[model samples]
Target: LILIILSPLYLPILNEIISIITLSYIYLKVKTILKSTQKKDNEELTYSLKTHLSGIKNFEA
Candidate 1:
């Protein structure tokens, strides 16, 4: 039957769409986590640098 023949084709297409959507969701989650980590790291670095500069100024005076 033509219906039987078409069912197999539809299954693979449906699977492929599901795979694409799952991968995209994973990618966005990873990107968001990385961005937040980067921001935290930058803030820590800035704080450390400021502390070091003040220490040096105190030593000079």
Candidate 2:
């Protein structure tokens, strides 16, 4: 069949496109996860800092 004749020529290009899509999808997932984790870390840091500062204030008072 003509399909078989052309498949070898197109297969590499198809593979490249599929790989690119998969990589971008993975990259996006990792980016969102990192963003969420960073936000949580920032929130915890701020809370701890606030408590520490308040403790100092009480000690000084």
Indicate which candidate wins on TM-score. 2
Model 2 per-residue lDDT tens digits across residues 10-59: 99999899778766765665565556567577676556556655664575
Off by over 4 Å in 1: 1-4, 39-61
- List the pairs of residues colliding in candidate 2: none
Clashing pairs in 1: none
lDDT, candidate 1, residue 51? 60
- 20: Cα error in model 1, Å: 0.3
48 in model 2: Cα distance from truth in Å?
24
Candidate 1: count of backbone clashes, pairs at least 3 residues apart or interchain = 0
State model 2's lDDT.
0.68
Give each model's clash number: 0, 0
TM-score to native of every candidate shown: 0.54, 0.59
lDDT of 1 at 25: 57
